[model samples]
Target: MKRKNILLGAFALLLVLGFGSCQKSDLPLDGTVSKERIAALQSNLKKALHDTTQGWVMMVQGLNANVRTAMPVLLKFDTLTGDVTTRTLFSKDKQSSKFVLSASTGVPLLSFSTFSYISQTYTAANTAITDFFFKVLDVTADSITIQPFRKGNIYQSEGGAIMKLFRASSDKMKWALDLLNAPGNTGNIFTQTSLFGRDLEVRLKASFATDSIRSRTGFYSWGGSLNVVKSNTPITRTYPTLNPIVIEFYTTFPIPANAVPLDVNTVVGDGLIYWQPTTALTPADYFLNGPNATINFLKTDYLLIKSMTANSVEVYAVDASGNVCITGRIGD
Candidate 1:
């Protein structure tokens, strides 16, 4: 009886040990994530965005000729606990662009662009800030399909560039993931501008209205041919005619309280310009003289001259070399 009891106890102990081993095997083991790995991933993502030779450089180069003409002033990046932020400043307009990313997923989450430019002595302010929430819709060992929740606003110029960057970067990302084995073609042309610019151009089509010319308006009208000169010689000449009139009118009447002056310099320098309203003027109160010509104004205590009686006006012309010459200002 004693030997049988001993045998039973030994069998029970063996069964307990076997069950414990099975339970331990069924539990999942922790896959540890190290700080060093996270840091390396962040670095790689930053390099991909700002890489001049291979990455976003191509996308940035495709910005409108005017925007690209201005050089960048500063480009900086900062690493946080699990994210990275990059900032850039442009030289011409002191414009800035910022980008933020997640370290773990190597995904971009936010982007912002801001700038102020002077046109015809008036200041124009522009800002665009966008947020992107990247959700992994599908993932495999070699590829990922992500749905981006994009929310933000942008000025016309920077908006176009941002759209282009997104499209180009998406294509590049796929190529990078494929180890460059994929073809270099993105279905869309890299040279095309955003749809927004195209829509704006269409909306601003030329129109005409006829009414009796108001007297004592204190209007100053200037018109000149736009001639592209290379090596001090005219390459292309765009003549000004009476059909499409470009004029600048100044008035101190009870203009709307929300009137804002357009930046004349930015308009003439760049093809398009935008302005915000102050108590003096609103953007809506301003009108373009011609479809091709952009108009902007400055705030002055008073209009220098109130009225003109002549059928025609005479104005001084400054040549490209800064030589002042007298030109006959013809009226329509």
Candidate 2:
């Protein structure tokens, strides 16, 4: 009788294990729920977009590489008409594009199907950011959490980028345009910025005084241009693209072999630079190979003007986990 009881208990355990394995295989992508729950979520997201009369202030924290420190982009969505309007600091007026909420992949996706250059400033098929589809992670009455939606309508295995849209004040657009070209601004790129466990007093190289004055650095090599450059002398480099916007710094610091080097000239200068691009010729992230070894490298991989204001400039760095490691900002 004892042996029969033991045999029956073993069979029951096997059945339980088999059922649990089957349940795992049946789970859907994107961690989505059943068909009915998905429908409910879709309806809720629509309401979230439509109920906010004042619109949203949107900002993207890039996917461990791109860093956008500009003022958040303003977005107003007309859910009834499917029109999404945008207001940029650089624009005098707002622009509109079509948007859709799709759920064919067992997950909700907010897709921006149209293209606008002015809009592309923040959302280009971008190195650090994109103005394309966003996989909706969570949504509420006043905020929506999102990630850039790569193709396949699936959750990306590559860690996702997080963006948030908060309620905007009615007069937020007042901070637009004309403010971008405000006067009485000295052209200094960065003051003292420390990131990746290093300090970069990003002042114009006093030793390279003759090479000083103004430097035109391109944040991107394509249609996008970073226009904060004006040198006392004309740039003599002969490159096809206006990329690797160079910022030279010379201290008794040495370059790290594994550190990311920024050299628009293709020759890494003594001062830490952030412009040596990969084959795509685009600035690559991952400034360090192992621990913040840049203490010795003295190289900086980024020095673009804050995309938000020309009155002040900032040079900052972000870590892989989307933390602001450190920041240095300057006005004038």
Report the number of the highest-TM-score candidate: 2
Q: Which 10 successive residues of model 2 have the least lDDT summed?
A: 230-239
Tens digit of per-residue lDDT, candidate 2, span 1-332: 99998999999999998887675466576654557676877888888787776677665332223332233456778888999887533232456788888875555878876754222433222233443667677777667787665522245463245776666643433332223233332232232222212333332222212342222222212123333221110110211122223332222234444444332321121111233222222233211221022222222333323332433345443332223343444233
What's model 1's overall lDDT?
A: 0.25
lDDT (10s digit) by residue, model 1, range 1-332:
99999999999999998887674454334533434444554455445444432222111121112111111112222333222222111111222233445533433332222221111011111111122333233322222333333322343221222322221234433432232222232211111112111111001101111221121112222235222111111000111110111123323224456644222211111111111221222232332122112211121100111112233222222211212222222222
User: Which 10 successive residues of model 1 have the least lDDT summed?
Assistant: 233-242
> Which regions of candidate 2 are displaced past 4 Å?
1-33, 64-71, 89-93, 117-131, 151-159, 170-201, 204-332
Model 2, position 7: C-alpha lDDT score: 95
- Reference-based TM-score, model 1: 0.26
The superposed Cα distance between candidate 2 and the true structure at residue 332, in angstroms, equals 11
What are the runs in model 1 whose C-alpha is more than 4 Å off? 1-44, 53-99, 103-106, 113-162, 166-283, 287-332
Estimate TM-scores for all models: 0.26, 0.46
- Alpha-carbon local distance difference test for all models: 0.25, 0.43
In candidate 1, which residue pairs get closer than 3 Å at backbone N, Cα or C atoms, i.e. clash? 119-265, 119-266, 120-265, 258-281, 258-282, 259-281, 259-282, 260-281, 260-282
